[model samples]
Every structure is written in structure tokens, then in C-alpha cells.
Target: MTVVVNENRNKRARVASATHVAGCRMDLNVRDFAPMAADEPALAGGTDEGPSPLEYVTAGLAACQLVTVTKIADAMGLDYTGLRVDAEADVKFRAAQGAMSPIPRFSAARLVVRMRSPEPPERLARLEELVEERCPVSNLFLDAGIAPEVVWAIETTG
Candidate 1:
């Protein structure tokens, strides 16, 4: 099948801003969307008002993968009934705290995609490949030397 290229893929600037609200807490705005907050757990000197910045990063990766998969599956004519994604990352607090450590802030990340589809495994595999290649957030992790391990669980009806 031939895939239609997006005409609006030209370069564009995206903007977001954050302001410190309190200890380890920040209020953020992105492109006129509803305001959001970020904060660390109480153990980290935060009131646990919202997810931490690291949590947002990990969640963004999962959400990006899900969106990329949906688009690629549509382009490939792959059928699916449901899709879910989970993401987690391992971070070295010492590095994030400005300690003298060789370890990167994020050491590793993993994404598990649970999909319910009737499509064949070969088709799904191709979709996975395209999603990994096209997902910007996943590429960010890879470029940072944190290779995210992506696992797909495709459930099919017998």
C-alpha cells in the first residue's frame, strides 16, 4: 500500500513556559492549552501536587508512541480494536542533583504496548517498526543513549 506524505510536515516552532510555584513545584503553559503543574514527591521536598517533570517525560514518550502507532496503523490499513501503553524510566537522582557522576539522568526506559487487533502478526510487526522510527519522543530517548525497550502484546480473537 502507498502511504500519503503529510504536506504540513514543514518546520514549525513550538513553545512552552513554566514558572516556579513553590518548592519543586512549577506551573506550566503550552500553546494555550489548559495550565498544568509539576512537582516532586514529599520525599523530594515537594508537596506531591502533580507529577514530576521526569514523570511527564516518561508519559509523553508513551503517549507519543500510541499516537504514532495509531497513525501508522491507519496508513497501513491495519485494524485494531483497542490500544494501551505504559512507560517507565530509571533515573539517577545523584546525577540530577548535580553530583559528580558519570551516569546519565535517565539510565533506561521501557514501553509496553497492549493492543487488541485481528490483524496478522507480520502486519503488526511492520507497524511497530514504523512507529519506533517515526516517534520523536522515542528518538529523543535513543539519542540520549537510553535505548527504550518496546514490547507489544497483541491480543487476537480466536
Candidate 2:
């Protein structure tokens, strides 16, 4: 099916995802896109075809942060050679499994951005501030009462 996107329509973006499940493993299909497999580990009775759902959430947070920082840096005239974001979350599964009430998504999360840049610490600090405010994924968690601890580590070079 050819989807005709109306340019005059609302600017909001939308994506559709469908999943085929068997046991603890499933293949996700996105519209006109490559299929991705997801599964739990052996302990959870899965073949581990790909990362678990929570893992994908963590990865998306990191990717969104990186992209936000990059765009902000470009606009702020900050020069950088390389950038990387390390992300981790305190994920608790018992809640989702009905074993625990008041299901917690992630108790906490941390994002550390490592960069090789010629810019000074102050500029990077400003960039970090903007990213925290602007990154949609990070804000999604924050608004849900899971404010992630953010860190900026830069190796300055000329």
C-alpha cells in the first residue's frame, strides 16, 4: 500500500508498529521498514533474537540525547570531533509482571555524554542544559517522574 503523506496536514509525525509473538520472542514490523526481533534471555524463556523492550527504550533515550546535543552544538557554534552517550536505567520487571504493585518503569536513569571537542567547559555546559530541556525522549522520562542524571565529560583538544 502506498501511503500518501499530505504535506498540508498537521506536522505531527506518526509511526505504526505491529508485532508477531511466539512464547517470549516476537518480531516487530514498522511500516515499510525492516523487521526487528525482540526476545528475553534464556532465563526468561526466550531465544534472545534481539534486545528486550526495556533495552530498546534505554537505547532510544541515548540516541535521542546524542541527536539533540549534536543539533544544539551545531547551532551554538560548538566544534566537536566525536560524541558518545552512555545510558543506563534501573529497570524493575516485577511490576510489569504483576508481581509488584505500583509498577515502576525505571527507578532512575543516567546519561553520560563523552565528547572530543575544542570548545571550553562553559560552552559544553550550556549545550548540556539545552539538551536536557529539548530532548523529547529525556523529557518524556522526566515528566513521568524519572529524572535522569546527566553528565558531560569532554576531552578538550586543539
lDDT by residue (tens digit), candidate 2, 1-158:
12233687757766867476887788777677788888877766787878987888899999999998888888888899779999999977443545544443687999999999987778878887788888989999999899999988889898
- Model 1 stretches with alpha carbons more than 4 Å out: 1-3, 95-104
Q: Which lDDT value does model 1 have at 126?
A: 89
Cα-lDDT of candidate 1: 0.86
Local distance difference test scores for all models? 0.86, 0.82
Per-model TM against the reference = 0.89, 0.83
Model 1, 7-42: lDDT tens digits are: 786566778998999888999899879989999899
Spell out the clash pairs found in candidate 2. Answer: none
**What does the lDDT read for residue 26 in candidate 2?**
80
Error of 2 at 152 (Å): 0.7
